[model samples]
Target chain A: MPRIDGPIAFRGGGFAPSDRTWAAVATLVGVVALWQAGASAGVIPTLFLPAPVSIARALWALTVSGELWKNLSVSLMRLAVGWIVGTVFGIGLGLAVGLWSVLRSPGMALVSALFPIPKIALVPLFIIWFGIGEGSKLVTLAFGVFFPTVIATAGGVDNVPRGLIRMGQSFGLSHTAIIRKIVLPAALPAILSGFRVTSSIAIVLLVAAEMIGAERGIGAFVLSAGNLYDTDNLLAGIVVLSVLGLLVSWVIGRLERALLGWR
Target chain B: MTDGLRLTVDGVGHRYGGLQVLHGISLTAEPGEVMVLVGPSGCGKSTLLGIMGGMLAPSEGAVRCAGDVPPDCLNALTYVFQDFSLLPWRTVAGNVALVLEDRLSRTACAARVAEVLALTGLTDFATAWPRQLSGGMRQRVGIARALAVRPACLLLDEPLSALDAQTRDLLLEEFASLITAAGTTTVYVTHNLAEAVRLGHQIVVLSRRPGQVRDVVRVDRPLAERRAADPDLMALEQRLWRMIRDDAAVAERERIDASD
Candidate 1:
């Protein structure tokens, strides 16, 4: 095996060679400067569009008063509860549908139909069914996250090399053992990718649920601030939501890297 | 303990999606013998090996193991995959340890894994992940995993075809040494004449598609005594080539014709 290869491996980092990290930063700074200038010049009403500086001030005020921390913790607690509920059932269902042919078809049909209907669309129905309480919010959150897990698990199992399964057979392992040993390990990367997608799903569902009926969540705060035309607080809430989504995704990514070490 | 476990394949026939791949093929592997399956591409040598390994079901015929292989076939067989199907998530030792996890006591299991790791020249690789190792090392891990099961019969599915010639030869010697020490009944599949000549006790040559038993040649000398230029080995290689070259040519032509 003489070396004849060029670029056998891609170098991983903050950005690839063709990336636009600097351009993105420049655009962010330009948008902030322009928005602040427009508001100060009275081109846009402060009540309609608070300047980036005022949003920053609101963020600092909330940060110092510890209101952000308290509300952020409450939102995160809801997220954790909802995610755990969804993840456990989703992973169990995924592994089940992935392994058994009898259960896969109708199971996936139900999931495909239910996964894409806006979780918010079900909010009113869930409110009628479970009342305007935690049950409705949780039901919405779980539904949003479960679909990706099922898709991931099935796709992972579907394309597993038949050779690997036969390899297990030669070891005198039973059919069940082959799935537990060979199939699961081989299917993990895809399953993990599915989990990654659902983290975003969890956040989107959480925000939507909060906006519909919640009193203490970031989404509720944004809605209330819009009702009062409090632009600084509304912009601040969006910033907090963005930050929360990023943090949640970052945590899932870290866990994925740690567990799926070979990848 | 000294009794031979003879595998008798009687009138085994099988087909895949209307295309018959094996036709009443029969062969035997005696206990502690290294039986090599050889023939050109699409000759069903692999399919035969699969049937023997119980990875595939033959439409007709049974794999009869007479001695040493537990009367219960599932308890006595192990396989080494060509792709070295080691679990990427598990370390080399972990892959080998999986076979013994339920059966052996932990202390003894650890020792057995350590011993096989050393036997396969994979001691330093016990903690290494599969992706971190080279092709040869991964195959060694596969061999170690099979051996760790303390199986009476070992199945090899073209285990060295993915490796470089040098690595293949080196590993071939290593496999011979390990099997000789263990005295396991082994069935190795490969199309390479040099591998068959170097390591096989009995070389079973198969015919192209709808495979049948074309010839069975016995190598009388010990693998250690059979040198590279041995006249018997060379003559056997020539005979084996004559049996397979035309078939290989036909298979190759079919591929080109299919593509065109």
Candidate 2:
């Protein structure tokens, strides 16, 4: 053992701790700077790869013209509605399967059978069933977000310590009280992490749904720009989607910090 | 104080499939007495504790609790598990308040929680989460939670085995006093002989594998007067050790024989 001290420090070949914010910012700035330089020098064709400044200009024009917000808001609305529907239902069923043996096997079988089928592949089928409108698009996004949430929530519930459950039982806690006071709080970390995964899935499905048959989403904006051969606007739409994903992730991170502070 | 409940384990035998873990183990923890079960590893002391606590069913025989359980008590028999089993999300007071929530009025629950926290010397850490506390402190929280219910019987499964030697020694004295003060019939399972002698009014020594009662020794001296340096305590520890020692050697030989 090392000499007794204030604290023992073990160097296990792990990455040294540092302020990573500056490094992350520097990497992004460096990549954009290199792209801008290449575009100006004509080594990369402007049509093939728009300069960062040009993409920014297109984004500004779309924003000022109120077009970007229109498409972006539509995508956001679809995402919110679909994700909420999927999450609420998934969590309800997940808790059922987690707690009740009668439901576990059947629920697990259905999830396993459906989880592997690429959700995007079912878009045309959804369109036929629900009609080529917001209904079909909402269904597409909801279906895509549903399965992973179920898997994650059920797994989280399963991971709660058996000792805690036994403690609840020994104390003569009612079934509802045991679930509400013990199981839910103990399993919240896993359930919240499941939310993170399902939201990402919802985003992917949102874009795909819009691409197939939609008029006013970021995906639709990109598709129209592609048809018109406007590379700058297409890249601008892609940038908006990237920022949306980053914002969702940041929100989820904040939720985790707030809810899982006990950890 | 009203007499505590009598927990009787009558010729209890337990098995997991074909493997017998305990056999013909009969014992009684009398009201207001501390009964420590001591044995070698794999001797099924914990399994027996679990059975006595009504957490598991014995393969043979039965465990019965008889006496006046307080009418308002939420749990007549509560357990302190080896791992502390404190819910990470709840504060010290909140965890203690858990069993009392449905059983008592809101103010009564809070008062009971406060009382138990004080009893366990955890009043200052009422709002602290389990993860913020040391291992010894967490176990105190466990004790506080169990005591909050004012159970007729307390079943402890190696409550001090997880702590370091110094912490164990320090807590052992506090534990002895606290249990004495509570005066609830306690069934404590431990591998430590010193702890057995220090805490138990009666110590039950068990043989290795398919554990059966080898000897039951009663300590006549009061807990407070039973010091580590006392010859009688030392002698009792040695006697208990000797009882388990032969069984341990025989177990080792049997294990080797089977492996070969």
Q: What is the DockQ of each candidate?
A: 0.62, 0.68
**Candidate of highest lDDT:** 2
Prediction RMSDs, each to the true structure: 4.8, 3.6
Candidate 1 displacement at residue B128 in angstroms: 2.0
Task: Score chain B of candidate 1 by TM-score.
Answer: 0.94
Residues A102-160, candidate 2: write the lDDT tens digits.
99999999999999999999999999999999999998888887888888888988999
Give the top-scoring candidate (TM-score): 2
Please list, in the order the candidates appear, how each scores on TM-score for chain B only: 0.94, 0.94
Alpha-carbon shift of residue B184 in model 1 (angstroms): 1.2
lDDT (CA) per prediction: 0.83, 0.91
**Per-residue lDDT of model 1, residues B100-216, tens digit only:** 776678998899899989888899978998889999999999988887777788888899999998998889888878878877788999978988988899998887777888889
